[model samples]
Structure formats: structure tokens, C-alpha cells
Target: MMKKNRLERNSNSYQKQSNVKEVWRRLRKNKGAMVGLVMLVIMAAVLIAAPLFVSYSSAVGQDFSLVLAKPSKEHIFGNDGYGRDIFARIIYGGRTSIGIALLATAASCIVGTILGAMAGYFGRTVDNVIMRSLDIFMSVPDILFTMAVVYALGASFFNLIVALTLAYFTNYVRLVRSEVLTLSEQDYVEASTAGGATSMRIILSHIIPNSIGVIIVNTTMNVAKIILYESTLSFLGLGMPSPQPEWGQMLSESREFMRNAPHLMIFPALAIVITACSINLVGDGLRDSLDPHLKS
Candidate 1:
């Protein structure tokens, strides 16, 4: 009997592993997603090793002789109006842009998830209060609200992140709340509740695990949106300060020289586009993979 049980457990484990492999196989078959994944990997590698290849000061340093230089062997993406190496700046700037997007997304997800889970699991007064407040926040224009927050708080890295998090958290709250509402009706959730599990315990153990798929998909897509919003804010002079090597700040500084040195604008713009597209592609793949109906 013991031997038979061991065999059955082993078989179940193998089956579960095979299912995961199959899901990956399906994801790999998506050409666009795969391409985007590859592009993202390359960009990430470049950004990570940027400092190793070029010092931070050198990237932002000014040299009148190199100002507005065209792409060449010495400077691959050439120099900007400040005579800073565009290639070096791009590599460094990617760190700021990608880092801010990820940090802001994580903050939004954490705050949103907690509030959304509480509202959805409890319902009634809790739901009404949380959802009503979120509704009021959603009513405001996202950009305008972000600008106001940043303006009031004083624009800095921390303030920028807080502003973006506040603006973006509403979507996650709504998404997670709806998911939790549906998940709370599942048999296991009811079983946990009936078994005398504490509300927090049931929410953390039973409710959250089941609702994770939708949450993950939403979080993935939100990264792209956050990056774009960060860039927009930076362009409007409310994002990370100048000389910080942020993509948006680079674009903002280059606007006046657009007629003279279009490469300055083109490279940073291309970086943002590629990053956003890659994230969106990955999000789409995750969505398809997580959908039960789409699973073969």
C-alpha cells in the first residue's frame, strides 16, 4: 500500500510538471511575445552592465568638442546638446526608467491588493467605503492628479514614485476587488470560512492564491503604462530631475535641439517604445497562458 501510494504521488507530480512545460510551450509559440522577450532581455543586459562599460560621470559630462556629434565608432548613439555621450546616457537612463516603473508598479500593487482584498472579502460597508473612495479618485484625470500630487509634494524620486503609485493604484484596486468578489464564492473559500479560519487567514491563504492570475496579468500590463506615464511626467518637467539620465528628461532636454540633433530625441523615444512594447507583449502572453479557455 505504501509503495502504491508513492507511485501515485510521483505520477501526480510528473503530471503537474508536464502541464507547466506545456504552458511554456504554448507561450514560446507566440512569435511576437518571444521576440519582445528577446528584445527585453537584450535591453536589460545593456542597462545592467552600463556602469561597467562607462562611468556615470562620463555619461553626463560635457565636452564642447563632442556636442551634437553624429553616431560614430567613438560614440555609437553620438553626443547630445550637453556633449554627453548619448549611448552611455541611454544605457544609464534605462536603469532609471525601468527601475522607477518597477518600483512604482510594486507599490501600487501592494497598496491596491490589500485594500481591494479587504473590500472584496468583507463586502457590505467595507466594500462600499473602499469602492466609493476609489470611484472619486478614478473620476479625476490621471495626469492632472499626478501633476497636482507631484507639484504639491515637490518633485523628487520618492515623490515621483508616490505620485505615480497613487495614480495607478486605483486600477489594481478595482481589478483585484472584482476578482476577489468572484473568488470568494468558490467552494474552497466557503470551506475555509466554515472551518473557522479567521477572515485574514482565509483571505491570505484561500482567496489571494486563487485570484493571483488576474492580478499578475494586470500588474504586468501596468508596468508599461507606468513607464509611459513616468516619461510623460518627466517630459513636462515634473518627473526625475535633469542630469538624472531618465528617458523622459533626455527627451525634454533634446526638444529645443530637435532641428539640429534629432538623434537625441530618436534614441530615447525608441528606447521607451521598445520597452513598453516588450512589456505589453509579455503581459498578453501571460493573459493567454492564464486563461483556462485558451489552454490546450
Candidate 2:
């Protein structure tokens, strides 16, 4: 009996390992996802490494006399309206842009996940109250809502993050709630409950684990959206304040001269588009890989 139990456990372990390998194999089949993953890593490396070599802050002393200087030997990407090095600003701005997006995503994911878990786990009145509040937020257009929140809280970096966090957290709650609702009714969940597992334990260990694949795919997609939203806010003067050297703010400052210096708008816009696309592609690939039914 002991030998038979051990053999069965080993077989189960092997099956689990095989499943993980299968997921990776599926992900690798997606060429664009691999490309996106590589690009993001390269971009992250540039951001981290560039500042170490360049001594000045993103927005440092500028030479107004040289304002709107086109790309040349001295400054590869040229100078902005304040004559700050455009290349330098972009490099440094990466840090802030990526950092804020990450923080906002994290904040949203955590709050949404917790709320979603509670709402789905405890249905009826609890679900009604939480979901109705979510509906109110959903009723407002996201950008306008974000703008209002930022305007009210004041346009500092921390406040902007807080505003975005609140705006995007709704996605997580809705997603997790849907997953939890489905999983909570599954046979495994019923078995857990029958085996005397508490509600919290069943929710955390069984329901959450089952829902993680959906959560991960949603979170990855949200990262890209958060980045775009951050840039938009910055562009509108509602995100990073002036002279801070953010891509969006940079675009805002450079817009007037866009007719003369097209490069200004081109580079930042390209950066935003590429990054967002890459993230989205990877998210799609991951979602496919995680869903066994989609595997072919």
C-alpha cells in the first residue's frame, strides 16, 4: 500500500511538471510574444543603464538659446523647448513612466482582487452592494473620471498614481469576481467545502489558485493600458508636472513646434505605441497558453 501511494504521488508530480512544460511550449510558439518580451527587456535595460552614464537629472539646467535644436552630433535626439537633451530626458523619463505604471497596476490589482474575492465568495446582498458601487464607477467615462480625480487630488506624481490606481482597479474586481463566481461552484470547490475547509481557506487555496491564470492575463493587459493612460495624463498636464521630463509632458511641450520638428512627437508617440502593443501581444499569447481548451 505504501509503495502504491508513493508511485501514485510521483505520477501526479510528473503530470504537473508536464503541464507546466506544455504551457511554456505554447508560449514559445508565439513569435510576436517573444519579440515583445525581448523588446521590453531591452527598453528596461536602456532606462536603467542610461542614467548611470548621464550625470544630469531629466530636467536640469537648460540652454534656452539652443531651444528646439534639431538632432545633431552633440545631442543625438536634439534639445527640447528648454534646450534639455531630449535623449537624456527620454531615458530618465522611462524610469518614472514605468515605475508609476507598475505601482498603479499593483495597487489596482491588490484592491480589486480582494474586493472581487469577497463579493464573489459571499453573494446576494454583499455582491449587490459592491457591484452597484462598481457600476457607478463604470458609468463614468474612464478618462474623464481619472481627470476629475486627479484635478481634485491635485496634480502631483503621487496623486496621479493614486487617481490612476482608483480608475484602473475596477477591472481587476470585475475580472476576479467573474472567475471566482465560476470556480466557487466547481466540483473541487464543493469537495473542499465538504472536507471541512473553511470559507477563507477554500477561497484562498482553491478558488484563488484556479482563478490565477485569468488574473495574470488580465493584469498583463492592464499594464499596457496603464502606461498609455499615464502618458495621456502627462500629456494633458494632469500627470507628471512640467519640467519633470516625462514622455507625455515632453510631447505636450513639443506639440507647438511639431510642424517644424516632427521628430519631437514622433519618438514619444512611437515609444508609447510600441510598448503598449508589445504588452498586449504578450498578454494575448499568455492567455492562450494558459487555457487548455485553446491549445492546438
By lDDT, the best candidate is 1
lDDT (CA) for every model shown?
A: 0.89, 0.85
Worst 10 residues of 2 by lDDT: 51-60
Q: Over the stretch 1-296, how does candidate 1's per-residue lDDT look in tens digits?
A: 99998997899789768867876888898888898889889988888888788889867789989989999998999999878999888888889888988999999999999899999999999999999999888988989999999999998989989999999999888888998988899998898889899999998876777778788899999999989998999999998877888999999999999998899999999999999999999889878877879876
lDDT of 1: 0.89
Candidate 2 runs further than 4 Å off: 1-17
Question: Which whole-number lDDT from 0 to 100 does residue 182 have in model 1?
Answer: 89
lDDT digits (tens) for residues 109-210 of candidate 2: 989998898899999998999999999988988899899999998988798789888898899899899999888889989998998999899888877777
Q: For candidate 1, which ten residues in a row score worst on lDDT?
A: 15-24
Error in Å for residue 182 of model 2: 1.3
Q: After superposition, how far is residue 217 of candidate 1 from its true place, in Å?
A: 1.1
TM-score of each: 0.93, 0.91
